[model samples]
Target: MPLLFLRRCGWLGLLACLLTACGSHQKAPPAFTASGYVADRGAMRLWRKDDVAQQTVNIVSVYSPYKGENTVITRYQFIRDDVRQINRTQNGEHPETLQIRFDDKGNPSFMQRQRDGLREKLSDDELALYQFEARRLLDVSQSLRAGQVILMQGRWRNGVMTTCDGNEVDPDFDRRSASWVAARTQRSTGQLGVAWLEAPEGTQLLLVANEDFCHWQPKKSEL
Candidate 1:
């Protein structure tokens, strides 16, 4: 009877070990990742989505100027590391939009630009610049990801902020910045949201507004 009891205990221990091993290996790589950096005159947030089955990558970048009301959003789509399409939209006093599609050989297959209610073709030089910028941003994103620089957004209520992923966090902001955020939150009639970037260097506040940033933010399906 004692031998049977010991055998039962051994089987239970082996089952527990197997379950733990399975759980450890069950974690899958995330389908999407986000990173960003502070530009010279503003902050730029980057969101990237990877489609492993399609061998495609999509990156959307939003650049908000510190002093101007202008906001620029650029989306780049790549197939197997080659640029496939680029779309950019700028909103402000002088709004403009650009769309470019490249062929499999990396040649522009379609291009269009609209400004001030006028449609125009991109000059060769402008097209080249856009292509260059797309590649440069991809390189920058790779470096940012490697450095673990990340962008996070959340809703601010009272003094607590609930992250988009449903986690509560106390962002590392300067006293003045915190006060400014609180003031804005208090003045806003709608839900106030905040965005920040985290890096090994430090944390930096990106934006504070009444809009629901996560609602319109790019998702894996949209990418």
Candidate 2:
């Protein structure tokens, strides 16, 4: 089992540290391939509207605070590969009023307004779907985030000055219901309201922080 230690060296997990994923060359920063969560509250632009369904958010995860809900408002086209990764996991029902909240212990649970028979803790395939949708919204938030969320993977070596902060890797994130992520894409009515509708399913994003912290932590259910 990996012991999560609260250290001043930031959130360099013991696994990554043991693997020595850290670097300090001063010039060539690592190009991380990871997903950022829009679980936090933020604003997003209407990047592209899905004239077909009229509701759907493509990506998420940003450094700065935002003013909008989960809506794509820009047409930037940055993270190509990250979009592909998110696309691979985008084959599921788009939630209308779904909200994912965490318990006191940092375990994950969910509640959607219109869904029936759904529980706070999901299981097996149910859990998978919840994660898929959660991650999808998070990725959409990442794409729309104005800038990159700081991320670095490596050992806290000696004399290696880095601007990387482990804000994403915090294991204790989403500890309360208020910190839970909630998103509801506005579905278009036929060809009308296209401006507020979600973008195409596979459109590329403009900017995304390669932070991997929000990827696997906050397990789906409490043990």
Best by lDDT: 1
Off by over 4 Å in 1: 1-29, 186-190
How does each model score on lDDT?
0.75, 0.26
Candidate 2: worst 10 consecutive residues by lDDT?
Answer: 190-199
Give the range of the ten consecutive residues with the poorest summed lDDT in model 1: 1-10
Using TM-score as the measure, the top candidate is 1
Candidate 2, residues 20-114: lDDT per residue as tens digits? Answer: 32222234312222223222343222222221242232333222224323332111112221221121111124322334444434245433332
Q: After superposition, how far is residue 9 of candidate 2 from its true place, in Å?
A: 37
- Output the TM-score of candidate 2: 0.22
lDDT over C-alpha atoms for residue 53 of model 2: 40
